[model samples]
Target: MAMDRLFAPPAERWQAVSPRLCSLRRALLTFWLGLLGLGGAIVAGVVGMWWLGAVIIVVAAAVYAFGWWLIGRNWRSWGYAERGDDLLVTHGVLFRTLVVVPYGRMQFVDVTAGPAERKFGIAKVQLHTATPATDAEIPGLTPDEAESLRDRLAALGEARAAGL
Candidate 1:
């Protein structure tokens, strides 16, 4: 199939997100939790006679907000495609990037569903490769799709390893 036919919308062509990645609800929820946790920590610190609570809270809140923004930004731009022998991940809003994971380099593939993902009927496929400290991930896939992709990747890795 042509690359365009294999991918999603043209708008998402640079970072073609999975149809399963519906919204940024997860990141928003995480941000709210982080804010609440930071507030709670500040209260606890003040109660314990620590004068740095306010400063810590301010710094923490700034960092948390930045992190939240980063997640939302990346989430909005993330997309992936499963090529014949490689997985293509395109992400980032500001510093756009594309990651290509060839079958030969993949160590293994995983299909995982967290509580939220399970509720949404989605799973994340994480591909571990020989590259140190760098793994390719494609999140927000339907359970069946995730499984199929996992099996395909595993088979490709094996085939490549066997010099097929």
Candidate 2:
């Protein structure tokens, strides 16, 4: 199968989602989760389950460290490029995955931001195609950027589909 390197020639113009994603992901995946885990451990200890509390504390620490690193790695791995006729979305650190969504194949586009994401002032854009398997998503964009991208992609898809 043909695939393009994330920053290779054709896709060299790849646009990153948002550099803030690493911090946002860290807050969501690690910070709050770590707090919860530690709280649970503390509660366990208060209930006379010292062994359980110790185990929980150890597990929480491990998860916090690993998740903190993973969040940054995952954030760095996401990138997208708009080629002439297709949108290239590539991600993953260990098992690299690249998705090329032809403009003509896009049925619709959606921009969304959850409560947590809104709090962080970031949003995501999702591209839908006739084939579910080929749909792609790009996250960690600012609200305005997400809306602009959604509109542009939708227009491009319509124009390209008309030609097909």
Q: Which lDDT values do the candidates have, in the order given?
A: 0.71, 0.86
**Which stretches in model 2 have alpha-carbon errors above 4 Å?**
1-11
Which digits, one per residue and each the tens of the lDDT, describe model 2 over residues 1-164?
34534435372566887876777888777768777888998899899998998898888888889988888888888988888888988888888888899999999998888887888889999999999999999999988889888998999999999987
Model 1's TM-score against the true structure: 0.61
Which ranges in model 1 have alpha carbons more than 4 Å from their true place? 1-20, 24-73
The alpha-carbon lDDT assigned to residue 118 of candidate 2 equals: 86
Q: TM-score each candidate.
A: 0.61, 0.87
lDDT of 1 by residue, 1-164 (tens): 57434334333334344544544454555667667767767787868945566666666677666776666676777777666667777666677666778888888898888887786678888999888555888887778778888898899899987883
Candidate 2 residue 101 C-alpha distance from true site, Å: 0.5
Q: Best-fitting candidate, measured by lDDT? A: 2
Q: What is the TM-score (0 to 1) of candidate 2?
A: 0.87
Clashing pairs in 1: 16-79, 17-79
Candidate with maximal TM-score: 2
Candidate 1 global CA lDDT score = 0.71
